[model samples]
Target: MDLVIGRSRSAAARRRREVAERRTRAIAAAAGVTTGAVLVAEVLRVWRRGDAPLPGETEDVVLAAEQAIGQTVEVAVAGYKGGSTRENALLNLHLSFLATFVLTRVSTRLLRERGRWGPLRNVVVGDHHIHHFVPGIAMAFLAGGVSIVSRDEDLDPYLAVPFGAGVALTLDESALLLKLDDVYWSEEGIVSVQITLATLAMLSALALALRVLRRGEAEVLEHDHEIGHGMPGMVVPVPSFP
Candidate 1:
């Protein structure tokens, strides 16, 4: 009877473990979907509507976009349009971080579960095991430094790519960073996942709040332009909101 009881307990425990894993995966998938949707929407907005005013360019594109998206959505778009270069740079930084967080978690799961089925599992350099974080870190620093010294609007997206990748790699080994030891295969690895999610959530909320708060100002300025009171032939340089 004791042996039978032990067997039953083990089976029950296994089911519970499976359920927990499924729940975690579900949450991660949801986060990934949400992040991808936001990124796609932002990119589509830029492609379809163009960017904020550049030097020697008029604000017509921004105005048109605002009109197309309507008041609620337009307010945020307008606020972004009127934002300064520094604001745009900060936005790029936030997006890169968020993207990295999502991608790292998802990729780690995929590689762990499906590694044997694909060539992805064989990636290496000679006898040394290549860690994605190494290249990610190098790219991030290189691009980040370049962005800091220069204000080229076009460079922001380029910088975001490397920075995001670097962040993902580094965060995947978040346990190592905190404890100075490799605990990636242990429960401690989840620390990186938690930090990534928390940071992304906070940054996203802050960005949304800033945009929402700027709505009234954006509307007022837009109203001035509509009434023909806005400055004509004056070019205000601003970064793209993406």
Candidate 2:
């Protein structure tokens, strides 16, 4: 069963820019994700290729060797490696935003219906209420914001700020949950002293976000049958902009 509201915000005569802004925000977030992926890939590629040590390498090489340690200028003419511009950063960010959104919003519903997780097992079996862990609103905002500010190479500042904030908040929220549940200390806790149970919640939320995205996409395919029968599209038009 799909839900169709009214016309999309675009139809209204006012606040045209806000509609466009939402699209832009999604772009920025997508770009940030792309940047992160690209950076990690580059790092791994360089690491695997056995690029020479960064600089001033010694036996006890943990952080002791500074760039200025030997006044080192090893001139082999092999220029440093890095890329300043990547393709469709914002568009990728928007894609990521949607991907995450579906994972959180859609998949959670399916799991709950299928009785996969405990909290929603019969309705779910446990009390985790895992959906709460997914940063739905925030994802929507950052993903949306990316497009709004794409003109400024938003991957760094806007995306990073929220990503940092999200991490901090996730940690804090996990801490609060553990404390509230009175499960802070236990035999299980002792076994995994370094990692908290909160992390499990985080993983569950991420899983939910991913699954929903897949299912939603599938459903979109199924919805093709309804389009011309006086039925709405998979994505309904919201009439809130104006």
Candidate 3:
């Protein structure tokens, strides 16, 4: 009789687990579909716009939005040094990566708390919990591989967005990867936050330095141009330093 009861309890537990897994998967699928649909709609709308003016109030709103975005970008990048296309793409990647990391961390914390934060929850399947880092690695790999294969400068900005997002996702769980165990939510998980902040600081500093260097170069070149134009028919001697 006890044995039969034990078996029944075990079966009940397994069913519960299975149900939870299914719920988690369903939630994830729904979120993914919704996000994809929104992205596609936005992309199509923008593509259709293609330099065409919107009607009346809509046109004014769109123009205002564009100007606001431009101003924000300029402020974010320290007065906008007028970087090359590739440099701007790189900046976008860094900013996107940082933003994604922050959002992922917040989302995970909300899910962990089991709050009424929609259907967000940890994904599990057959006694295995799938970490976000898995998808992150795959995304980063695919984006990087395509970028390398295509070798197209024009496509860098597009590829960089996904690459940045993937990197952020993976790094958000850096502690787990380093320890080879699920250390998230533990003391060890703090390492991941530390690493992320350090990375952000380094990237921000590097970007600022690059901008300063570019600005200095531009000033020097402008001065040289002024001097050259001011003294016509004068050949400037090249200075040699041993």
Candidate 4:
């Protein structure tokens, strides 16, 4: 009887530990997927859309997509024709997205190089508090920094809404240590809320990429000799994003 009881207790403890691990993994996995997808999306958005107005590019996304991604089921959603100047606003949205990607990339680098200057993690940055508060917050600021440009892209900020919200929520959730996720571990889990948020974040990041490329092009045009290698449009300046 004593042997059986001890084994049972041990099994329960093991099960508890497994449960905690799954939650952690769920959050981290969500962040990773979000980040990667954002990167890809930003790359494409910038490639196609080009630059936006500075100092307010981000606002366009918020005005358009704020808290909206979760609300939309049909991929067609809104956000296509953002404002009175819908075309311009869309361009700015793309610009803000490009800048966001640059910032996210910067945060990733900090995780690697500035980990000591910031927080400590168990092989994963998102698992750490500093990752949430410091790097995550910085990225959030980039996301929140919007303008008429962003506002102009007023139709929908689908990617920005959920992506920003998810990062903020996940960071908070980690801090609170919510033991809500127990089933999404080491398996092909369902397309959860976290998953959707991550997708939105990825698309936003992709938009940022396009903005940066467009900005780089403008710079190259001003000083053509400085940049030795780039395509023709690579150096052409895009009008201030809508």
Candidate 5:
């Protein structure tokens, strides 16, 4: 009887902690959105006052970025089909963003209604609704920081998890960020869905264009394969990029 009682107490305590975590995450999300608004306002205020720093001043601020990241940037650039680091990063960021959006939509649909068992139950903490974006935001920063310092390309896939998660969470709160109020279930909340869909469409279009361009380049190379032969029975391998 004592053992059963102890187990019950532990479970109760764990439930309380989970409830507290959900509340904490909700508060943090609110604070983050508020802080972002204030920062944007500050930047606009400075710009209007003509107090913004010069373009060169901004360059100096990030001048040490290359030195700080060391060879990570080079490795990313080299791996990106011979594309520049900026291009590679942007492409991956968009792809991850779209993926996160799709995931959030599916998970939200599945977890909106409660169940007695399975992973969907994990979405709710006590009576409080826990957003997946909360964990996503944390993971994104943790993984991004690790990827920045590591030179291994194999670890790059791990970096996508956080980026994708954080993005989904942020996009779901898009209405909150824009209106500075909670309107997630109302008509206003629909704005978040619209924005997420539009962004994904644009990113998909860009990715398709890039693929077509790559295919065209490959076809051009194939034509050259026959013309570039120097000797009979000699085989040459084409170089691969990215």
Candidate 6:
């Protein structure tokens, strides 16, 4: 009798897993199709707009988006004193990581609450549940590897986006890793939030410090240059012999 009950339980568990896997596959397929469609649409739009100004009401929307993005870039560059490709890349990475983390947290919360995100939930395979960190690790490694091998400085910022996103994903589950089990949605998961906040604070402080240092250096250099060139209205000090 006990054997039969055990078998029944196993069968029910298998069925539930199968249903979850099916839902996961459906969600993945839909996402892929949507992403492909958007990419194709963007490509066609850009191709059609080549060397020509956008006309009509669409122009307003496009210009608005472009302006917003441009302003964001300008702000980041100014804040980080991003005068070089590497500095710009780091700034982009920092912004991307923070944005990804915020989005991830919101998505997870929605899923937990069974909100409007239909058919998208935890990924389960057989008896084990796959976490976001798995893909996060893979993405981080891939981005890091590409950045290491690529010689183009222009590509660094692009790579940094994905690398930052991956790191954010991984760090979002830091508490799970620390506990060696899923503590997400539990009180213990608060630790992950704390860690993420701490990291952001540290990075922000470091960037501010670096910017201050660079600005001071530039000012000193400029002052010295003016003194060396003997610019008008500039005073120079000379040593007096005793």
Residue-by-residue lDDT tens digits, candidate 4, 1-242? 99999999899877766776576468657667866776455434432333322224465664334223322211112232222343433444444444444344345446557664245332455654333334545555555554323764443454354335435434433423334443322222222433444445456645543444445434433343344445546766668976
lDDT of 1 by residue, 124-206 (tens): 78897666667677877888788788968767755766676676666666676688766554445564455456456545745
lDDT of 4 at 79: 31
Candidate 2 matches the true fold with a TM-score of 0.22
Q: How accurate is candidate 4 locally (lDDT)?
A: 0.44
Clashing pairs in 6: none
Candidate 2 per-residue lDDT, tens place, 103-132, comes to 433444466477565543323237754324
lDDT of each: 0.61, 0.39, 0.65, 0.44, 0.54, 0.65
lDDT of 3 by residue, 1-242 (tens): 99999999899866765665565456446645754664344333432332323344364766655644443333334423455667766766776787787678778878878743676677889999889999899989999999899999878878888998898888888889988998776545654354545356345635653563345434543444567576556778989999
List the candidate 4 regions with Cα displacement exceeding 4 Å. Answer: 1-16, 19-171, 174-203, 218-242
TM-score (all chains, Cα) for each model? 0.55, 0.22, 0.52, 0.26, 0.46, 0.51
RMSD of each: 11.1, 27.7, 15.4, 16.7, 20.2, 15.7
Question: Which pairs of residues clash in candidate 3, taking residues 3 or more apart in a chain or in different chains?
Answer: none
lDDT (10s digit) by residue, model 6, range 150-171? 8788889789889988998898
Candidate 5 lDDT (Cα, whole model)? 0.54
Q: Candidate 6's error at 183, in angstroms?
A: 1.1
| Candidates 5 and 6 compared by TM-score, better number | 6
Error of 2 at 91 (Å): 19
Over 4 Å off, model 6: 1-82, 115-120, 195-242
- List the pairs of residues colliding in candidate 1: none
Clashing residue pairs in all predictions, respectively, total 0, 36, 0, 30, 1, 0
Name model 5 segments beyond 4 Å from true.
1-80, 84-86, 113-118, 148-161, 176-182, 204-216, 219-242
